[model samples]
Target: MQPEDLVRDHTIYACVTGSRAFGLATDDSDTDRRGVYVAPTALFWRFDKPPAHVDGPLPEQFSWELERFCELALRANPNILECLHSPLVEHADATGRELLALREAFLSRRAYESFTGYALGQRRKLDADLRTRGAPRWKHAMHLLRLLISARDLLRTGRLTVDVGAEREGLLAVKRGEVPWPR
Candidate 1:
């Protein structure tokens, strides 16, 4: 089946992510959408299996096949875990709801390692930007700080939450470049 067919017919869960889902949106924030689609099991029997992911018939939209999504989730992938927790759910069928119900099962102490590793990688990119452009991307810096804080709090409390809640203003300040890069 075509990638779009998989998304259009098989997508079981879909939600808004990025700044909007994190309660960090400004008037111009893009609505980043993510979702999971389950390819028919029989598809694997074919000469070519389904694409593991699809980039979108909609702008800024993307999705993963169910098995791939689960594999990543099991590894405590930061982006997949956050996608499952996004509050701005746009679509969900029974299968999708079942997947959401398994959100906690997909998390563990491993988050500290995965989230921190991802943050460190992002930090390197920011560092490169600092050297090349003379200024780090303020938005990336803000999100990196936000991810670290979230990971720290999740490790401490055993609860994963996407919204910044009380830290919204300060994070937005960082996004606006009001905070110094070193700070």
Candidate 2:
């Protein structure tokens, strides 16, 4: 079936994500939407299983089938795990709510691996940017710090907290490029 078909007919959960969901949108921030959809249980009977992920008929929109999302989250896929924790949920059905209830199951010491690995990957790009442009992508650096803090807290508390909570102003300062990484 088409990606749009799955999104329209089977979407079990949906949310606004990225900077908007982080409570950190500026006037220029784009709205990023994300979601999970569940194919009818009977769809599995077909010889060809549904695709694990789909991109939009709408710009900047994407989705994963429910089972596929869970599987990837279990494997410590950072993007999939973050999708489960996005604070700006726009829609959720019974199945979707149950999935959210299991968010903790998806968390483990494994995040130290996935989260740090993601940070390292971003750092490389920042390093390259510094070489080419004489500065790191300060915006990406800010988010990396935020993500590291989140991973640290998740490891310490065994809970996922998406909002910056009391760190709002500090993070905003970082986002605004006031907190530069050492050169």
Candidate 3:
């Protein structure tokens, strides 16, 4: 079967991610999609292993094979961990639901490292923009700060929160370039 067929036939989990899932989407924001697919159990018995992942026939669509996904989440890979916790789920089957139920098992103190590392990387890019443009990408700066706060709260509370909650207005103001950054 073709790779897209695998995703179509075997996709076990799917969600809207990025700004949409983060409670930060504006009218023009792209819908970022993410998902995991489990290759049929029979596929592994063959000499050729199933593909580890497939990129979309549709824009903004991407998926991972289940085993590969679990491996990354076990290592506290920020993207994978966030996928499991995304609040904007679009589809999930029994297997996918079981995987979601294991979300906490996949999270550990290791996220203290991974989450902060990811946030710092984004912050660096925003800083670079500030250096060259006399202003940072305020939208990116806002997301970086949001990510840092998420990481801090996760470390302190051992809970993951994908949505910005009551902070939506403040964050959107940043996105509109209304928030000030120190020179």
Candidate 4:
């Protein structure tokens, strides 16, 4: 079967991600879609297995096979974990709903490392950008702070929330370069 067909016909979970999912979207924000699909059992009988991920039939879209998605989620990959918790799910079969229900099972104390580690990496890049460019890219700086906040809240609450909620304006201020980096 065609790869796109897997996402088209076999997808079990799909949701909006990126700035839009975080409630930080502006008029120019691009819609980033992420999803998980279960390949038909029959397809595995062949020597060539179904792909573990697909890069989209639409612009800025990507999907992982269910097994791969689960593996990443269990490892607390920030992106995959956030996708499962996104407030805007576009589609979900019974399996997808089950996946949502199982979201909490994927969380563990280990996320403190995974999320913070990811944020730390981003932070270094932003620092380097500032050193070389005289200013960090406002958009990347905005996202780095957002990610650091998300990691802190997740570790504190044992819950994952993507929306900036009340912090939206402060973050938007950062994005607009109104907030100084030293602050």
**Alpha carbon lDDT of each predicted model:** 0.91, 0.82, 0.87, 0.92
Writing each residue's lDDT as its tens digit, candidate 3 over 44-101 gives 8999999999998568988999999999999888788878999989999999999999
For residue 78, what is the lDDT in candidate 2? 70
Which structure among the candidates has the greatest lDDT? 4
Task: Give lDDT tens digits, candidate 2, residues 1-183.
Answer: 676899998888888887777777888989888899998777788998887888986788989998888888988777777778988899999988998888888998888898888888778878898899998777777677777877888889987777767776787787677885788
**How close is each model in CA RMSD to the real structure?**
1.2, 1.7, 1.7, 1.4
Candidate ranking under TM-score, highest first, comes to 1, 4, 3, 2
For residues 68-106, what per-residue lDDT tens digits would candidate 1 score against the true structure? 999999999999999999988999999999999999999
Q: For every model shown, what is its TM-score relative to the native structure? A: 0.96, 0.91, 0.91, 0.95
- Model 4 — which ten-residue stretch has the worst lDDT? 134-143
Name the candidate, 3 or 4, with the larger TM-score value.
4
> Which 10 consecutive positions of candidate 1 have the poorest summed lDDT?
174-183
Which of the two, 2 or 4, has more TM-score? 4
- Model 4, span 45-108: residue lDDT tens: 9999999999999999999999999999999899998999999999999999999999999988
Runs in model 4 lying further than 4 Å from the true structure: none
